[model samples]
Target: MSNELSVDNLVTGYGKQEIVHDISVSARPGQITCIFGPNGSGKSTVVKAIAGLLPAWSGRITLGNTELTGLPVHAMVRNGIVMMPQGGGVFPRFTVMENLRMGGYALDNKQVVEDRIEALIADYPNLQRRRNTAAGSLSGGEQMMVAIARALVTDPEFVMLDEPSAGLSPALVHETMERVVSLKERGVGVIMVEQNIREALPVADSVYIFAGGKRKFAGTQKDIRDDNHLMSIYMGGD
Candidate 1:
């Protein structure tokens, strides 16, 4: 497992404002690389830029051998880049199986898709039990499961999560993070933007702190634990 995804000197912004400026990042294969920052620090914006929701104003984002700095979202997906947005990127009206099927829409192999679905169900009982339930009716935790399962449907090489643990009970948050960890066990690169810094730190193999649209600090969890530097840079200062 080497660098599965890499971003270099990225410069991007919305209509009139640039949020990510001259930024770079990389997610090593089978590793959980987390981007942590206070709100408005352009973390999610980075995800958008990578997932092709926003065009890269400048710089290169290379995934494996693909230079995907400005590829459209659809093209990115076909290229093995998929995003699991926060708040559960589930369609409220669709059943679990329906949502999962949509994820593999790009796949022409019907048997492969069906096999994968059955395998995911065996691994995640939560999804298996609620296969027929409308996604909207599930609890926040259950919905999160559906979202992750759906994203896996595409057989993504790298899965970017935007606050996977955001709005759930503590128990549910733990469940969501655990699910994310499971993805890594299966050897998928995960880049996440999480607000729960404390909980994320434990699972994060590498932690990146962003401030003013640039990387303020970067290191492993042990390198930053209980250190005042994180709060000094990521607190109200920025």
Candidate 2:
């Protein structure tokens, strides 16, 4: 009943190599928890491990009182945990409507799916305008919106996103960050791995900065801004 997603001492990696060391983090409802680092810092690795896309070599992942350690990806979704990977996680060939439908595949009721889709279209006017358009045809920002909206079709309690602002314009990056903040307002636990430090810092409630596959700092926005050492790490200084 805690309504928080917690990862404890997580260690995961590709075959015969550990990319993520023993790292612990938590995502609380109604707040944004950001994980940020330079390339190869294992930020995405941790996200994948929590999403059940990668197996943890050790440690535990929990949501409320439920243990999510070994659950498959589908079971994680059923348990109200959704992961929207990087690069706009939609089927490129499918229409926006079809992609939305696929997002609610876990639901058994057709009316529920329709209702959710309708609600999403109302929330995102762009989606309504492009409902029949192929997902691949949309711009980067629009596709990002579809990926996020699709994740919400299941109404997940905990949502994870990887580098949503990777290749977006300044305006679109601002817009995307705003949408992420809105997710927290809706009482969803948001765990975001972002490279856009400027955009991510303002909206984040807490932050974890990783370097060399290990957590270098974990604190609030103010803490990050005030610490010169942390800033140095971000600037690629040894």
Candidate 3:
């Protein structure tokens, strides 16, 4: 598959301490390509650079045909790349509906934004049930649903989520993973950072493991499953 987003010779870090070494990666259209590794493995840092949350020390990041390196977060969003950082970024004091409205600000077409919000609520019924509730009142998993929905309000083509399943219960985690799988059916490209390798592997079209600031492995999910021993060596035994 070709790439919707591509990064070449990428290097980034904070205050002179490089966290990501020269790395090349790609996310193909209509697929879930995941980044997995233990903490501080440069997964989030590389993602932040791609999402325009951090400055790229060196490298090229291209989304579609446009260059994204050194662009601000808003610029990235304008390019149809929206990121939902870890913690969901929900507004504690705001109602679910209000939050959705804020997310749709970029859409000047009121009917379109409303239609998108309704579609999201329909997809996640739990969110529909709590449409008028304050975001802080919802449980962690529910909050995650809201966050993803808010990101979708922009009608983004590429959505990058950081540690999406972090605080959810087992059932909620499964549901969230299912949602990731479903994104491609909606024609959205997803790049996610996940700690739960076992769950993510089943849905990923292709997977990439980042270790020591470099890509340790990149292949189809079936390829990894075919060689169980290979996964343990490359993925650190889950």
Best by lDDT: 2
Q: lDDT of all the models against the reference?
A: 0.85, 0.88, 0.84
Cα deviation in Å at residue 49, candidate 3? 0.6
lDDT of 3 by residue, 143-195 (tens): 88898889989888888989888877889889888778777778889999998
TM-score of each: 0.94, 0.93, 0.89
> If the candidates were sorted by their TM-score against the true structure, best first, what order would they fall in?
1, 2, 3
RMSD of 3: 2.7
What is the overall TM-score of model 3 with all chains considered together?
A: 0.89
Off by over 4 Å in 1: 1-3, 225-227, 236-238
Clash statistics: count for each candidate: 0, 0, 0
- Rate residue 229 of model 1 by lDDT: 69
Which wins on lDDT, candidate 1 or candidate 3?
Answer: 1
Better of 1 and 3 by TM-score: 1
lDDT of 1 by residue, 135-207 (tens): 9999887888888888888778889999988778899888888988998998888999999987788889888
Sliding window of 10 residues with minimal summed lDDT for model 1? 229-238
Compare candidates 2 and 3 on lDDT and give the better one. 2
Task: Give candidate 3 regions above 4 Å deviation.
Answer: 1-3, 105-112, 225-238
